[model samples]
Target: MSASQAAEVVRMGVLGHVPPMSYRNAQGEFVGYSVDMARAVCQDLGWTCQWVPTSLATVADELKQGQLDVAAMSLLSTPERRSHMLFARPYYTSISAWVARPGVALEAPGTRVAVVQGSAQARFAQSRQWTLVEVKTHTELAQQLAQGRVDGLLAPMMTVVGLMAAQPLQSLQLQVQPRRDPELTGAASFGISPMRPELKPLIDGALERLERNGVYDKINSRYLPFKVN
Candidate 1:
């Protein structure tokens, strides 16, 4: 491809602001740390970014079908993902936790935990044997909890915290356990189809540069307190 062709702008898919990571505002404009980083990398590559926005429920299929060159949406690099895509080294790390109503807490064996399908938390719920209620959107999960349809939710801590901040209610409470096993509680890395092996190296290099230049922290700080090591 010629330079112009290479810079012709690539399409990226986003799970549209489910919190702390990526989301769309009332104007239908995208804003989030992940989107910024993706844009920065595309800029560095002399390429333009065309966002192919969709719900988190269908992002995986979108990537698989070549509808997107990369997923700007935050996704874990699991064996299942590896079977289909390449991934950059992790640019961020966060722990998983459960959210419940203010007076209700999660208990084992009988708990009904709502998790977003295809998310790491879904697998965690299965492993723990929690009766799973899979949902397409975080908003749906939160609504379920509010309506007492589910007992709790499982997701990255900062995301749940951001959700509670954005929609304050006495019924929502996030419980975090920092010491859980990595497989069950920790996630990092972004998913990219292996077709663009070249893009993988480029993205990895760009991430390194972002970290060195403190760009990552700047974007991340907008939503979460990354400084709290």
Candidate 2:
């Protein structure tokens, strides 16, 4: 569309947590794979978009309240989540891993583990019968591992990778659980708010084209070392 048609700005809600996906960088700008992908979608659709940084808990509320048109924070399309919001084609898949300090053999069922607040890791940890500790933020999760408050942190692999890159914890080891399968793997889609049915296909179309043209990989690989597809 021409500039006149792009006059209206799209409001997108993004994650303020979760590195390599979406997070406020040291420069205070919200930049990551998810952010860049959303920007590309908006650009392809000829819409000017404003990214609003939000947490996982509030992003759904923001979308429900009609304050945001899209929530592009590597959102998993679970049954509960699909009840109200719509999802565009998945841009990336999320995988879970266990991060532990050095010399900590945490492969047993009763090992103590920490999870970020309101994360899918909680359910997996519970399923394994591991003792659980909940931290509200990524930094707190790291602190728990460092202080020996927990044996390890069960978090997203991308997040664990980012942590390992930023601060090379000498003892930190990111390991995949033995039982990891469908339950532990989920697609991370760009969630759309309801009442804007027209926007879904437009974003999806843009995403399809971006992926076909290899733009998606470039954007994704910029923040994450591995391809999540």
Q: Locate the minimum summed-lDDT window of 10 residues in model 1.
A: 170-179
The best candidate in terms of lDDT? 2
Tens-digit lDDT string for candidate 2 (1-229)? 6666477588888777667777888888888888899889887878888878666656666776687888977776665567768998998778777777556666677788988655667656767777889777665677777777888887777777666665535455544443255666888888898867778888989999999989888997787667776
Give the per-residue Cα lDDT of candidate 2 at 221: 71
Extract clashing residue pairs from model 2: 102-171
lDDT of 1 by residue, 1-229 (tens): 3587465677787767566678887898887777877877777677788888776556666666667778886666666666766777676666777677555556568789888888777876778857899988876777777777888877776567666766543444544443255765444666676666667877788788878887777777776765521
List the candidates' TM-scores in order. 0.88, 0.85
Predict model 1's lDDT versus the native: 0.71
